[model samples]
Target: MPERPILVFDVNETLLDLDALRPAFDRIFDDPGAMRLWFANLVTYSEALTLSGAYVPFTDIGGAVLRMLAATRDITISDADGAELTERFGSMPPHPEVPAALRRLRDHGFRLFTLTNNTLEVSERQLERAGVIDLFERRFSVETVRRHKPAPEVYQGVAAALEADPGDICMIACHVWDTIGAAAAGWQSALILREGNAPLDVGPQPDYIGQDLDAVADRLIERYGGRGPDRGRTMPPLLD
Candidate 1:
């Protein structure tokens, strides 16, 4: 079997696309470029919060991004638009290949879960909106871990919750830092190819790097026979 027998996914860019908010952001800022800058700042501050030993819901992060963008661009956005964009984050759509790939992984006897820096409600609602809520057995949020990706504890916590050894868990992410952290923690890595994402050099790099989840799934199946001790393991937290 492939080294990492358990598979955990990073939710946002790795699977879901928050592009639904592009139009929303455009309307607020009167410029499409504003959305990119806003998201960049959102990720920046999130990492800052984790490094500073503080945690905030992704909802707060959304608002913070809006404020940051407005100030930086010298534009004003109405409160209604702010609320709409905040809510828009939850309604992100899963990537085109995600649902099918997730189903294949389940059918092939792989355990699946999500590990995201987004808050629980935000993550859950995103999955539900994408119509793939059944794909992930559990949605793990940093809100509980009080840390974010690239933190050993964030990745380790997922392994702990699933009762899997770090070496036996694979983290699928598009972020180089996330894969680097997982590799450092002994987990297998899969880089779900996405625009503007980078790769890491740790320990021989990711075991699989694919343009999408389906391609990654194919590589995993090829590496590991996919049939396992539990061909029919029960859905985890979702079932509980």
Candidate 2:
């Protein structure tokens, strides 16, 4: 079992596959790429609001962004169809390697938790749908803190919630911004390089990088497993 620091995962696009929503986008917008656009815009605007000291529920932001995207393209979508976009967000499946990797990490005895820019309700449903709810000790959302990620409050809030020093948490996610945010907040971080995702050239580099969840788990177990819970640690930054 790895000693010290909680493994804090980002739910969307990290454990749950956002690409699975492509078919919904295709059905609604007739453009498979619409899912990609909607997600990118959602993240972009969410951060924009956070930086401006504004706040909104993550799901509300998601639905609003969908409408805005439709407007930009002169695409009129009914309210029901708009709701469907985010209604399905909480039921995405895990990526192919997610379940096994989660089990591997759990069996290694590291504490596991999720920190997301989502509501607690949605995060729970998403994990449940993915069938990995039992693998996590808790699910955290920035909504409780009323802040979205990349903001220092979100990461610090997780550390506070876990009753651990910020350095005693490892943030694992596929988004460079998410890892960078954790790093800046003084937590260890891993970048899971899912396809169509890449680390940003700016900010502190992640402590580990991998092709998938399984690859990330391999490195975590190798580095931190079997230390009998006394592996007092460092905040060394991993280079890109």
Candidate 3:
């Protein structure tokens, strides 16, 4: 267990896998890469809105992704299909290994919280579907900040809510830029190596990297020791 608190997550891509929407997107757009492009554009535009000092709800990002997919593929995306894709988003299940890993961390006395750009209702429904509702002590949504991932203010809000310093919270995720934002905000970070996510190239490499959350929990036990809580040491940027 960490002697100090450690908030450990990013919800959408990190906890809930929305890639379940991929085939649905392909069906609607007649393009296999439709989901990929939609997700990419969603991240890009969300960041653009935040940087320009405009506030948009996270669900609005979904609508924008749907619209972009329609235009790029020259296919008419029906309102029914668009709602289905997001309904898939709301109905996501956790990765196979997440529940056990989070359980081990909690058993070892590590405080847990989740931070994400997902709206409250969406996240709650997804977590309920996955049956991981008991895992997090708190769930911090970016709805409060009206911004997306990789934003320092959003990360800062998460830290503030826990009364935990930025450095004490470790941002764990499958996305490079999400951890980059956490690091920029002075948080410890890790990459949960997942299929299709390329390795990160951030200046400060994540403090830990693992094949899955279970591997992450094992490494956590190693670094901090399972028998007793330990204060953090500055983890050097990962470089090979």
C-alpha RMSD for every candidate = 5.7, 6.8, 7.0
Residue 48, candidate 2: alpha-carbon lDDT: 97
lDDT of 1 by residue, 2-43 (tens): 453788898887888867788898888788687778777777
- TM for candidate 3 is 0.89
Backbone clash numbers for all candidates listed: 0, 1, 0
User: What TM-score would you give candidate 2 relative to the actual structure?
Assistant: 0.90
Order of quality (TM-score)? 2, 3, 1
The residue pairs in collision within model 1 are none
Deviation of model 3 at 55, angstroms: 1.2
Give the better candidate number (1 or 3) by TM-score: 3
Error of 2 at 108 (Å): 0.8
Model 1 / residue 65 / CA error / Å: 2.2
TM-score of each: 0.87, 0.90, 0.89
Q: Give the worst 10-residue stretch by lDDT in candidate 1.
A: 195-204
Q: For each candidate, what is the lDDT?
A: 0.81, 0.87, 0.79
Runs in model 2 with CA error above 4 Å? 227-240
State which candidate has the highest TM-score: 2
Ranking of all candidate structures by their lDDT, best first: 2, 1, 3
Q: Whole-model lDDT, candidate 2?
A: 0.87
- lDDT string, candidate 3, 185-224, tens digits: 9999888887667666647678888888888888887777
Indicate which candidate wins on lDDT: 2
